[model samples]
Target: MRTIAIGDIHGGLKGLVQLLNKLEVRDEDELIFMGDYVDGWSESAQVVQFLIELSQKIECVFIRGNHDVWCEEWLETGEVNMTWYIHGGMETMASYDDFSDEEKKEHLAFFRKLKLYHLDDQNRLFLHAGFTSMHGVEKEVHKPTLYFDRTLWELALAMDNNLDTKSYFYPNRLKHYHEIYIGHTPTTNFKCDIPMNAINIWNVDTGAAFKGRITGMDIETKTFLQSDPVYTLYPNEKGRNKD
Candidate 1:
């Protein structure tokens, strides 16, 4: 069976559908979504519904991204934070306008059930954000996947900038997996690859919601598929939030 992992969708439902159509996924294929499934675009509800339908046909794994976590929190408590809403939560909230209260509750339930990270039996790890501490310690830290508890992002940025670095692995004894698929940080090149021992970490958040292309990677084949460029809802753009 072919195993394909898609990067942060970020409410680009049309892009997601287009990419899936291009891939022509089959019943036996396994599709893993790296999360951030909602927000940043105009079709959050549609995206969730589409994934729900797709889950019936294929083995799909959904992991929660930072945006998704914010969505859950806002939906549950009605306490929206500016940081989250400014990033992408506004579009996600607007996507549910057409849904009834019950439907919204169901959607929130789905979001809450999403895993922070996923590890296959083959040792391939998929997460919306990179592990701050080591992978094992991630589950122990409160808000491990979403919050910036450690310096992994800082270290990654330093490394990417060609600065000197210390040891690559954290002290938690979680061996680097074959490859870690992550999204969250937007990269100009559209993709970034970092090698750590036997593992290769790939960041594939191409900023689709910012009029950029959405990327899909075939894990087994190590190939990529991209979507056409689309317009994005600019911040403070009047009427842009209409569902």
Candidate 2:
């Protein structure tokens, strides 16, 4: 029963499909998606539709992302956020052109049901972005921080790998989880097109919204698989690269 942590899809359904084909998933396997399922490529609606069906067949944990929040709001209120628009929301909206209102409602429900974070039985923590609470996610005051914060990853990167957990110097937040998996900030930002680890925090977002590929990592073995560079799969679309 492998537990796989997947990176942000950013509406790259082709990349997601390719990555899944490489995974050869099993019925007992648990899939934890890091969100941003929409808002980059041409298949935002299709990606959401696929995930909805996939969840019915397997154990799946979905974390809500910043872009998802914007999308959810639009779906419920029919008000488009200008910021979200300039950052690929237009593509997402257009993708839903063929979907019925009932189907859109179903998709909205999926978005609303997404968890802010998931703490596994083994104490592994998974979230779309980060949290600011030094105490841990349970104590987080601003819920939105879970999807929008970057400081947690920044701190993980800045921490000394040698820092002992017993030492006063260790981060209080990281101490609460055996492992942390996140996907908001792409690993590609560091010029690496693969999942990256900083101490116990693993970043699986390999910039699928741009030139990097979608990634999936086994939580226990740390083994991973990826699709071809997402841009290559959708050659006609620039994805978020144009931004």
Candidate 3:
């Protein structure tokens, strides 16, 4: 069975749809979504609805992203934090406003149930952001670290050779899994604009929230199937204004 890991979608339903078309996913294959499925583009609700249908058809492992969590908080309690709104949350709320009560409940449940990380059969770790290095990769990681840390990626990138061979290993961060895949830190920030591998760590968030394309990579082959420019997909509106 093929294992496909996707980068953060950031509410770009058009981009996600295009990227998935490129994937041509097989039923038996496993899908690992890196998350941030909302709060960037103009179709957050549509993106959630698509994933709901997608989960029924594919063996999907949905990992939680910070944006998804924030959305859930509002969905469950109607409590909107101004900070969230400033960072693309307004778009998500606007999109969700069109959802019916039942639809909102279903989407909220899906978001509330998302996992912070997923470990594949190959011992590869897939997460939305980074992880705490306090414990080994096999040990359970804290939820916040899973969707918010960047130090993990930095440590992996700075390593000489995958960290296993380092003479003075710092147990505070990465290279503990056979391979680690992350999304929070956009690859566009690194100027790659595509899924990139540093040492054994893969950074898949190609900044779909901004001007970059959404990415879906075949984990085994390292083949990337991407969407058209996300900004172009939503020409009339601003994506995450901060992207």
Give the clash count for each candidate.
0, 0, 1
lDDT of each: 0.68, 0.95, 0.85
Models sorted by lDDT, best on top? 2, 3, 1
RMSD of each: 4.9, 0.8, 1.9
lDDT of 2 at 123: 93
Pick the TM-score winner.
Answer: 2
The candidate scoring highest on lDDT is: 2
Name model 2 segments beyond 4 Å from true: none
Give the TM-scores of the predictions, in the order they appear.
Answer: 0.80, 0.99, 0.93
1-243 per-residue lDDT for model 3 (tens digits): 888899999999999989888888889988899989999899999999999999999899999999988999999999998888988899999997778999999999999889878886778888888766557544645657778888878877776663454556644445366888899998888888988787778998998998898999889999888999899999998887553
As for TM-score, the candidate ahead, 1 or 2, is 2
Measured with C-alpha atoms, the lDDT of residue 48 in candidate 1 is 88
How far residue 138's Cα lies from its native spot in candidate 3, in Å, is 6.0
Clashing pairs in 1: none
By summed lDDT, the worst window of 10 consecutive residues in model 1 runs over: 190-199
